[model samples]
Target: MPTPSVRRSRPAAVRDRRAAASRPARREPLSTKQVIGLILGGIAFLLPLVLDVPDLDDMGERMLAIFLLAIVLWVTEAIPLVATAVLVIGLEVLLVSNQALLPVPEDATAYSTFLGALANPVIILFLGGFLIADGAAKYHLDKNLAAVLIKPFTGSARTTVLGLMVITALLSMFMSNTATTATMFAVIIPILGALPSGKPRTGLALSIPVAANVGGIGTPVGTPPNAIALGALAERGYHISFASWMVMAVPLMLVILIGAWLLLIALFIPNGLGIELDMKASWATDRKAVTFYVIADCVILAWMTESLHGINANVVGFLAVVALLVTKVMGGEDLGRLSWPVLWLVAGGIALGDGVGATGLDAWILSLFNWGAMPALVVVIVMGALGLGMSNVISHSAASNLLIPLAMGLATGIDGLEPVTIAVVLALACSLGMSLPISTPPNAIAYATGEVTTADMTKVGIVVGVIGTVLLVLFMPSIWGALGLL
Candidate 1:
């Protein structure tokens, strides 16, 4: 008798998943940097016990201490972001709610005051975004979308470059800019590689990073910084809906992209190279993909028509997540695929926002600035400049985490300035960094292609960055004012 056929083993990804789930959770020992973070955190926690700020209540001082510790850990990332988030919860409960350290008031519950941030509406909004983005990826929707969009600009090098940038921007609005850049990088190289070495090749390569950076400004879920700003403002009762954000940011992005395109043409790339671009379409009527499309479209529509629909953005977001799960567009394993660290990072920021309000730190910090006489436009320019600089050095989300609180504080004394507007501008400005490969993931991705040099990036980056900043400074106040956001 023939031997029975042996069943094939599960794929590596599946095996890894089962192994991960079955293994007991391990507590990894801290590294040297993490130990340093702990030391710093301990000092921050103890300082309030030793010294006090004038006019700050006991609770305020303690909260500020935790805030300081969080700032250090977050900036350094000495520990995992989720670990920092868990630490934030634990510290707040121990310091803020424990009667042994401080009296618990009738209005505050440790469970209620601190843990609420974990379930914040903004977090749910991102949850929805994550699910939708995951579904898009699972179906290769972004790639298909790009293939169709790039067909039009196949003839002219400048238009081809612009078209590529446009597609990159659109994809970045929903997908992570990093993922978008990586995906498009593959498509761009084959087309440009055939051409002789020249400016058009360099120009095409440069457009991906520039466009990816600018594209993220178009939506709340487009980048972590946007979510951070939205979550912080929402905590303060300033609601910036999905539609409102897109209305303000999309126009700004378009103008900036136009300026960037012009700068690219003038500086590096020549026109009319006649590159023949042909991207094959893949999504026509695949059942699973079509289901995903319908669900995603409806969710986005509801989010945009929020005023008419009366459904909260968070609710809409959660609905999308549910729909994805119910349709099996994403599975339990897919949950592992999501960027949980980013979500945790945002949670840390929300907790910090909570701490800011509880400790009266926001008001106290505001007191330090004499912004009563500063023009709102100057405030925009200064804040935008600060954001641009900080983002180049750290994660844009970290930049937003540091800057949004200060922006909120500044908003109080500056007449005609809205906290929401400051939050929006700061988030947008964080995406304007492109001078160095270190500035953003997209820039680093482009640099990795070996097509563009650091000097090449810097020369073009400076011009584009300046153009973006000026456009933002010129347009932000007017747009916000017109929208009655100021």
Candidate 2:
């Protein structure tokens, strides 16, 4: 006795589900949007190759054009991330024929752009550190800490968020952003599952992801983008020490964590969730556990900054994960659990950014923007926006890799501006984790929890992203300028 409307809707719903789950056929059916982008990409590809265009004659111009095309792919979400990496690398190194990109003086190697970027110690350190983070999860240290921290705060959603952020921040200081995120996800799933299935529970469940995003700001290893920024800074001769980074890092993370916690309190629980914490089990922290955590962290820090021979940071980190897991210091399953997607994405980001730099594209793009004449404050704002905006489009590590070099190039061009100071702003902005689910690993991690929709995350991001950026723009001059970077 179903109505005509109900009968029709059922068939259509089933068909839609089938279409969504269908794998890409050997001959993929192109969407209207994809078709349009493909056409545009084709024109762009051919224009430089066939016409021998004057602007294209310069390597810089062509590189900028290609970067813009990558942006196009980013906007449309048409290509896989790795596919963009391949396209960018091939176009920048192999295809480029302009003499300017390959000027014979000083730097001359056939596969310079391609091979040179990979040879960078900073990139190596980043990859190595990520591998270490994967190893950390193989031991259950991350989960133990997460449980120890949040178990006491289960009474309210705000507490859960604050607890998660604090723990994640601490773990990230030693682990990769991706690994930190995965570990945190495992911890939260249990608590969220325990919540009463309703609107209040839903809001609280969403808060844990927000905590993770905020938590990522606390340390260098907390996220890959920060690691890339720091690694690149070291390689570029900035000499930013571990102690120096913490001064800015601690305050930045605290500001976001506390602010978000307050916001959650206001929005989700006016009177509070009225929940209780398990004090006997959670409050009982073993000093031995703390010692292990501290020792593990210091070792990673040494590996990151100090030369330990041919052993890379990733190797050291993974070994630490193994030590912890095998020794039963942390639970075994946690170390084995890691996110492969993030690891590959970061690698692709490294390739993409290196390709851009290798082409001298960043230098040329800076020329086109013409921001050298602007005031110091104006320059900072523009650069922050550029970094944050670009980060929104792709991964944060890629943004840092691109912007760090751009900042270096533009620093001298602008009057009396310290390059590292500007670079720090860009670096910090790289992991701001606001604006979109795609913005950062932490944001993406939070988005994937299903407690928060894209719209909800976006709303939170718009407000917090603005606040976070302003904090950097305002804080950097005082902090870095005091230290004389400005």
Candidate 3:
């Protein structure tokens, strides 16, 4: 007969085997898109080096090669996004930086100029935001807040979805869009399971992602593209404070969120259906949870009052990071869990922008277009549209990374166009893309629930996207002008 310990060990081993068997296998073969990306990326990288272009210097040619390679790789994701980002940094250092293996230009930047991107002020700001967001999840504050705040909208299905979207947007303004969607869905899944499947289910499922996506536009730390834009603008000496970003974006975010809610209700939710969610709140009162709550509130307060206190948002963000770690509310595991990939991606964009400006690639690219002939508003509108369309097919951050530096370059040359306005418009437009499952992580989450079909997301996404983009392009610039935000 086996001993009790032996019997327990056998079951544990059996369970581990079962878990391994259930896991999905990685695909070793490249897809058609990736194959094309790899081939074209190589060709693009070499084209600048091989062909002589008018007035572009050797360093400019090298930077152009790096730029083209980035475009292909980012759009098709032949390599991981972060991989391409680091590649950009490495290429800049090797080809254009003062440490270049091949020398030509007297104005080559120091390698640290590229490496320093990893620690950009915006990156530091995002680090603090990530820590606070992760702490919220660990402490159950997000879910519990949802449970309590969702009570008034519980009686009717439409009202319930409105409440759900409102809370989702509120959370997304502070948390990452993906995290907000996941947190809301965790609470919503049980309710979804309870409901009869069909349009009502689809409507409820779609609401969370739409709200989360739009909510990300509400604050600077809400999404990666926002950080990319901020970093690029800061490099150009145009600074928008944390509170100022919210003031500029939250109004538009609310409009889009409400517009999406109405559209979802009109299209998917039946007129008479009602939804009931479990509203029991289980607030955590432990010492660690209490400490986290206090820290989060203080950090948020400091960010919001930057104009009053005269403290930089980056410093406030770092302060939060130090406070949480010093208090031991978050330890090594939490630090390790921060979105390092996203940070790297943002850093890569900053470095790419630095390289472009430093190498005069921006001037060469600007020479290709008669941007002076076009109306300043038209230029911004075109860039916004490009951002929206590209982000629909690729990663939003990638779209921003490719567009922001060029847009900033255009801003300098165009009369009556501010770099801040164009940059903000581009970032906001990227956030508006959610027409397909792959458009955003939040949309992907919704689609993965198996409730929202591609067709379902497309119809809603197109209408919402169009409405948001039109309003953003037609009205936002003038509004910002009137408010002196620019």
Q: Could you tell me the lDDT of residue 421 within candidate 1?
A: 73
Q: Give the top-scoring candidate (TM-score).
A: 3
lDDT of each: 0.80, 0.61, 0.94
| Model 2 score (lDDT) | 0.61
C-alpha-based local distance difference test score of model 1: 0.80
Give the per-residue lDDT digits (tens) of candidate 2, residues 201-291: 5455455555555556555556656655654455456655444566666777788767766766565544655555442323324654554
**Model 3: per-residue Cα lDDT at residue 357:** 93
TM-score for every candidate vs. truth? 0.86, 0.75, 0.95
How would the candidate models be sorted by lDDT, starting from the highest? 3, 1, 2
Positional deviation of residue 291's Cα in model 1 after best superposition, in angstroms? 1.1
**lDDT tens string, model 1, 392-429?**
76678777877787788777778767787788888888
Distance (Å) between predicted and true CA of 184, model 3?
0.9
Q: Point out where model 1 deviates above 4 Å.
A: 1-49, 80-82, 98-109
Compare candidates 1 and 2 on TM-score and give the better one.
Answer: 1
Model 3, span 1-486: residue lDDT tens: 976664458889899999999999987899899999999999999999999978998999999999999999999999999999999999999999999999756767999999999999999999999999999999999999999899999878889899999999999999999999999999998889867799889999999999999999999999999999999999989889999999999999999999999999998887778766767988889899999999999999999999999999999999999999999999999999999999999999999999999989998998899999999999988998998899899999999999999998999999999999999999999999999999999999999999999999999999998889999998999999999999
373 Cα displacement, candidate 1 (Å) = 4.2
TM-score of decoy 2: 0.75
Stretch of 10 with least lDDT, candidate 3: 2-11
